[model samples]
Target: MKIVKVEEFDLRREVEYGSAEQNEAVRTIVSDVKKEGDAALLRYTEKFDGVCLEPAGLRVTQEELQAAYSQVEPSFVEAISAAAANIRAFHLRQKRNSWMDLQPDGSLLGQIIRPLKRVGVYVPGGKAAYPSSVLMNVIPAQVAGVPEIVMVTPPATGGKAGIDPYILVAAAEAGVHEIYRVGGAQAVAALAYGTDTIEPVDKICGPGNIYVALAKREVYGVVDIDSIAGPSEIAVLADDSADPAYVAADLLSQAEHDEMASAILVTPSEAFAKACQAEVERQLAELPRRDIARASIRDYGAVILVDSVEAGIGVINKLAPEHFELIVEEPMAYLGLIENAGAIFLGPYSSEPVGDYFAGPNHIIPTNGTARFSSPVDVDDFIKKSSLIYYSKEALLQNGATIVELARREGLEGHARAIEIRLLKEGKAGTNNDNQ
Candidate 1:
């Protein structure tokens, strides 16, 4: 990690929008899936995942779900159940009911909040298992009252010919019964355009590789997506009072995610900055994913020297990081000062993983400065709100003239005439109608 002045440090890292070839490949895959349906889906599965399956084998059976429990340990099930409860409880708080308002003019106006009919959660597999992601993605949609929640993961797990047992267990624990043995851009395509095996989903949510990201972009209008997420990031805003060892560990937690992942530290104390930098170096040497973390730290990690904690907040606001940690003496005192960040961890005890795994907050967050305008995945992402407007006869008569005037000002005579026709039929228009 390099140490530099806050002015010299730049946090506007470029997002990977995928290569032209990757985009063209995703387009071809999406088009094939849309045209050939299950045939193309199975072909892509075998091509990319090195697994062959018939249309009947695409959907994971209940026997597999039950067998998955036997593969995982009792402790693992207990832990996942506990985490699911926390995730479910947290998202349930975000649930909203449909509501309406009655006005004095006898008009009914409000919003009709309803869950999406179905949602698809794409969990990345092959060589690694993200059971946490399964819980994080599925639990929110369940809390939103989505009738059907489906999951898609690569057919191969750890380069084997089956899905990861831990992932299957997580899905079952999260209340998702429909699981598919498919993944990547093809899976996204299948979810957008229904096949004989998989039904179309109203929305898709989860994190994936560049191909997955591009696939989500391709099917955005056909089916809504959570976001075009970028590489993971973590920015620590700490002062001299914070511990360097704890800070270094927290930074590496995100840095280990991938080479593109960023881990930054902003501090007012030069001594503390140097200490954290050395601690990060010491810890990086021992990390299991040291190669990935080292590359991430070398390319994207930095220790910025700000004039004060107040100055650090300004830099953080500009970065709009996906994950933020405040380790100063009084973390809450500066909480309101933070203007951007997808998830915030305050104090030493509130590590980034707490929110990532067990702290009842969704780990799927906006990345690559998107926290400036976007948010982490929540119940709202799984639901849609339709505006309700029941205009009474008297209400329309009272506002019809104003509506006509506004419409005519825009040179939309058709709109003006529509309102005029209603007003004239109600006996409210007198001598003002060009229709006469």
Candidate 2:
């Protein structure tokens, strides 16, 4: 890991930055899926996943999910069920209610909050499996009262179309309406456009490979997306009290995700920064993904020795990290200073993975530097709001002239005439059009 004073300005961008090949590949997949629909999905599955699945077999069945529960250990199933309960408990607090306000003039204005008709959650399954992702993606939508929730994951090798038992169990526990054994760009396209097998969704959520991210970008107009997520990243703002080993281990946790992932430390203590660097080196030797972590740290990781804790907070807000960990002696003191993190973890006990799984917060957080504007996935993603208005003759008569004048000022004669015509037809205003 590189240790540099905060003044250094030559840090390389994270490795997960998109490349031409990734973009091109995503474009090709999206085009093929757009043109061919289910057939294209089958072809891609065979070409990329090495599995040939019929359209009917693409949708997972209740029997399959039940079998998955049987395949998984009782203890694992129980654990996923418990996690789902916690996730549901947390997101239930985010549910919104429709509200309306009536005015003295007999006009009513309000917003109607309703759950999406359907939603699709994409869970990555090939070499790596994330059962926790199933919980994070589905539970929130369920809490939002979405009528239908579907999930998709790539089939494993040997032409298996079954989800990981843990993932299936989690989905069942989270109340997912359906599951599909399709993944990658094709899965995203399937959800966006509605193929013979997969139904179109109002919104798509979850994280995937670079191809999935690009596919989401392509289909954004057809269906809503959470955000264009990038590689995972974590920025630790610490003081002298933070343990070097804990800091090093937490940084490596994100670094091991991919070579493009970033792990940064900003602190006022130069000696603490140096100790973290040494501890990272010692810990990297024992990790199974040491080579990937080492490359990530060498390329994108840094220890920034700032002048003060206040200055460290400034650097963190400028960076806008996806995951911000406060490992200081008095972590709560700086909580109000943080304004740009997707998820903030305070103190040594609240590690990133805790939020990723057992913790109730959604794990599908904004990545890169998008935390400056984007937010973590939550119940709000699966709901829509509609503005509603009601007006009585009395209300329209009272505001009619003002509305007409404003519309006429904007050169919209038709809009002005509509209001005037209504008033005149009701005999509430004169055809001569005099203000008196």
| Number of the top-ranking candidate, with TM-score as the measure | 1
Best by lDDT: 1
Model 1 spans with C-alpha error above 4 angstroms? 157-160, 430-436
Off by over 4 Å in 2: 10-17, 426-436
What lDDT score belongs to each candidate, Candidate 1 first? 0.92, 0.86
lDDT string, candidate 1, 1-436, tens digits: 9999987876678876999999999999999999999999989888888788889989899999999999999999999999998988899899999999999999999999999999999999875779999999988888888899999999873335688899999988887888999999999999999998899999999999999999999999999999999999999999988989999999999999999999999999999999999999999889999999999999999999999999999999999999999999989999999999999999999999999999899999999999999999999998999999999998998899999888877777888899989988888882254543
Name the lDDT value of residue 297 in candidate 2: 94
Model 2 has an lDDT value of 0.86
* Clashing residue pairs in candidate 1 (N, C-alpha, C atoms within 3 angstroms): none
lDDT of 1: 0.92
